[model samples]
Target: MVRSTNSAVRQDAAPAVSERQQSRVAKRAAAAKPAVKSEPIELPQDIDSSTAFQLIAASIFRQVGANEGAVRSANPQGVHQMRIGLRRMRAAISVFAQLVDDPETTRLKQELRWLTGRLGPARDLHLLALRLRRARGAAPERQKRLQVVETMRNEALATAIAALATDRYRKLQTDVWAWIEAGDWLGGAARRQVPRRARDFADAVLAKRARKIARRARELEALDVEGRHQLRIAAKKLYYAMGFFESLYDGRKSRERMADYQRKVKELLDHLGALNDLAVQQQLTGSLTPVVRQSDGLAVIAPSRHERTKTERLLKSAGRAGRELADAKSFWD
Candidate 1:
């Protein structure tokens, strides 16, 4: 187990940001009309494997377009939504990598990566500011400086907006759409290799993912933190895969079966998410304390004295959740 040097005490020292404040940050980035010309793409009810990939990619692409207006306005939610759209697009591209291995798909993925990078600083700073907001317990004088946090957010937003205005960003929209609509992968040898059966593909992919999660869960008693993080990633991938193939579950019984599967998967995923958040904060908590504490004499909160205890509890919960997921029935079959 690779232990994080940043203790829970350090994490506790970060001030609490209110939900209202976070919402305001998202709203402050001024908006204008969407710059992209792409129309919204809708996914059909039933789909084959390749069609499913194309539909997901297209829908996410449409999300980027729809959010562009608010994003241009500098809405934080717009940035968040567009960022999600990028993430989902990237996931689809990865899942379907064998099918879409041409130069164009590679280039588009790279461009999306670039945009994601550009958006990351603003998003991270926004989160830091919100997350570092002091909870009710601390003295008002010791709270993290909301003003300074907002200033940093503005600066990061400027960079994001500038990147969005570039010719490359504009071209990425058109190019990626063209690739999705008429990729060489749609026909010939590629099509022959990649089957059109969404149901079969979903079963194989999800079953493999579930097996990994099950294997990891059963062995959690012996694994380290990094080893468990891999489990969380697997869970997330399986969750996303389930979402993509959900429409294929056609009957009332099938849909009910899917609903139960979704609920169980969500529970497992949430627990996994909690573990990942703690692990990330463990590395970041102590390093961030000084900067958050010193900005214009604002005092940061004290690190939680009980951090070690909390970590132990969280790990235990993750273990239980992992076991539960491993034991759950297959939704894909």
Candidate 2:
């Protein structure tokens, strides 16, 4: 799949989203390679695939700009939001792979991974630190241990800042713009094919993807740590794909129905995300700090046996949500 939104579009009516979408069309197109495979879905006479790709990619990319300040300020929400934006863009590229398959596209995706990795650790540590700090404890020795965790978090954030300031990050953004606006897709052999209408493409692809979710959901209760991890990842990928294609669906009711489905998907993702974070923090703090403070024997505030019950509850919720999504109708229908 040339990251899946693989078709063409004309810039007739100017919407704010279109303007933003067009903004990333890179002026420096000196580095693109020859024909790549993309989603290659047949475009209907009424729907332009290229325009749809632009809008989808642009919406995902735009959030990065607003999120920068928040990440810089060490706000966990900022880092979290930026990570979401990057993940969505990656999925968009996957969803529209055929239409925009350049070496630069690969490079940009790698950079996104690198950048998100940097942000991920700092965000995780920040969250863990905050949780540790808020636990009711008045002992001076406990305060000192908290301070050590805080120091570790600050060091991680510094590393993230360095990654953000690098030239590669800027270059990735530039490359993404170039890929989005590059008219190379219009001139490809793909342009010769009568692609399916955007609506039809959405319906087909979404239904196929939903079936995967349903299959995964069937064994959610039986999944081990790694199995559950894979399920969470699949859910996220489907979530991003649905978001980009939602615009292809007609009628206010259809849009609302999709929106409702998206929310359910998100709820599952959040529960899984929280569970993952709890796992990470437990592993991280266990390795990074002394279980018992050397000076006063103050123990770490890691997730307790009691927390296992909470994790189980979250898993149940996620499974239910995933099943609901799997059974839901394709919004494009």
Candidate 3:
């Protein structure tokens, strides 16, 4: 009986376009723009929780290796790619954490967080440096104006790279891998069952994600920037949890709602992501231009500054959207 702010609009909502129609539209778009394809992954019909967990953990471990390699080589593209891999792996954990229930999963997730924090500054600098380098390529004369920018970029990149190489970062990665190979995830905790096994599992998992999303939505509504970011993280997990059990919860309209929530979550996350980038950039700028703060130097990087503003607006918009989604009774039921 929760009333949405846009209750009237939602109550009188038009009949949804069929899922078939949705698929056709996507098909047409893909045909117009060819897309990348990885081999289809098939989830097993009957899986022991431990094996299922290992599969996901293995994927994450591979991503860590890849990202760590990029951090070492200072490859911007590699770092970006690895961040994506880490995201997917993180999503996988949220989706299947119950299956992989362990004393260590919490510990491992914390470790992953630390790794993300360590790499964040470096990744931002790498992205900024790459963007500037690409722009510099378009106009040769621009180099004179960019020398200070380049020096700043180099200093930031070096600091990030050095941080990545530290013993702490290395140990963090090691601990993650060790957790994966630990093989004692469940600690032999026995699971009781509801009459419907798969269905019950699906319901429980979805319910857990819903509760998290609701908590996050409330935080966001309170205008807590950090809280909003935290909520986005929860929403991403919820999005992927529904996806992992797609076959079990194959309702067309419900799937659409999940996708909608995912989009909103990403939109919000992008805002915080931009702010984080600016923080790193500001640090780099301060370090590289210690002597004289030139107006031109700041002007040259004005576009990134504008993007920061744009992302802040998106965060607010996304917060409203999240509140709407969270208040929907159907979203929880």
Candidate 4:
């Protein structure tokens, strides 16, 4: 997505919540029964599918902007907020796609996937760096070295930021904005052509990738190590597809089974993600070390031998998870 001109206005201006407020909110949420919060403004019962979808799409865009702002501003809470926004946007798309019959929904999903993928590495690195920083004070000599490592990490982060802020990201963002503004999500089929049978929508969506994934899951069981890795990618795409539409199906047994499948895919994805992160950090840290120690550059590259070891372990752990995802009995089960 292109960066908005009103970046400041794009973000919510609310002050940061204190720990006390967070505790209270958590308590309230935990004490409540599961319920969907009603929107402040009620949507008309007779509203057209296209209209309803446009409203949801607008919300999705706004949320995406907020997340992007979080990333650009280097705010941790903003980052969390952005991740939540992405999840909610995904959920909303999955739920409402039932009402509106459009292939563009799939296209938008692909766009979301792209946007989220770009942010994923940056978020992971930031989280890992924060974790490492918290542990640094306990080891004095190590602390000094870790601080050096952190300086290099910051430089690497800046590079990621520069990439995100470039024209490419902006162009994508602008294209998405144009779509939302013009309601391109309501493509091809007219609103009047859509039937009232929600089941039809669910069927269309469920059938989207269900058969292929099931076959792939079976194939995954018989593949060699590399083949299994390939299979896991298919599994993840299908899992995300399922996750997108899980809200529409409430059949007790099926829902439970789908949830299980989603969890398995998520586990595997997390593993792949960790492996990716470690590789990035290792490559980045290695590159920055020479640059930072040079006579004319920022003096930051100071990763300790131990920190490098941690990166290796992270990579190894990811490899194991990838293998498990590929080799597990009943990749679907």
The candidate maximizing TM-score is 1
Model 4, span 1-333: residue lDDT tens:
111212211122123434554444334334432212212222343444455445555655565565554455444444445554555556556655544435655766676665554444434445555655775457554354455445433333333344457787677567666665564545553644454444344355455545554455444434444454555455555554454344555567666766665666677567545544444555444443443456344454455687678756754654555454344333121
Model 3, residue pairs in steric clash: none
Summarize candidate 1's per-residue lDDT along 23-71 as a digit string, tens digits.
5545654434443332344445556777777787887789887877767
- Could you give candidate 3's per-residue lDDT for residues 1-333 as a string of tens digits? 111212222222223434554344334323332212112223364544455556556655575565554445545445555555566667776666555556677776776665554444435544555555766255543453356444433343344355567787678677667766664654542462322244456567778778777666655646554565566566667655555554443467866766665566565556545544554455444443432344443332334555567656766766676676666554323
| Per-residue accuracy of model 2 over 159-189 as CA lDDT, tens digit each | 5545667898878777777777774554562
Residue 179 error for model 1, in Å? 0.8
All-Cα superposition RMSD per candidate: 6.5, 12.8, 14.6, 10.7
Best-to-worst ranking by lDDT = 1, 2, 3, 4
- The superposed Cα distance between candidate 3 and the true structure at residue 103, in angstroms, equals 5.7
Comparing 2 and 4 on lDDT, the stronger one: 2
TM-score of each: 0.77, 0.76, 0.60, 0.51
Q: How much lDDT does candidate 3 score?
A: 0.53
Q: Is candidate 1 or candidate 2 better by TM-score?
A: 1
Full-model lDDT for every candidate? 0.65, 0.64, 0.53, 0.49
The better candidate by lDDT, 1 or 3, is 1
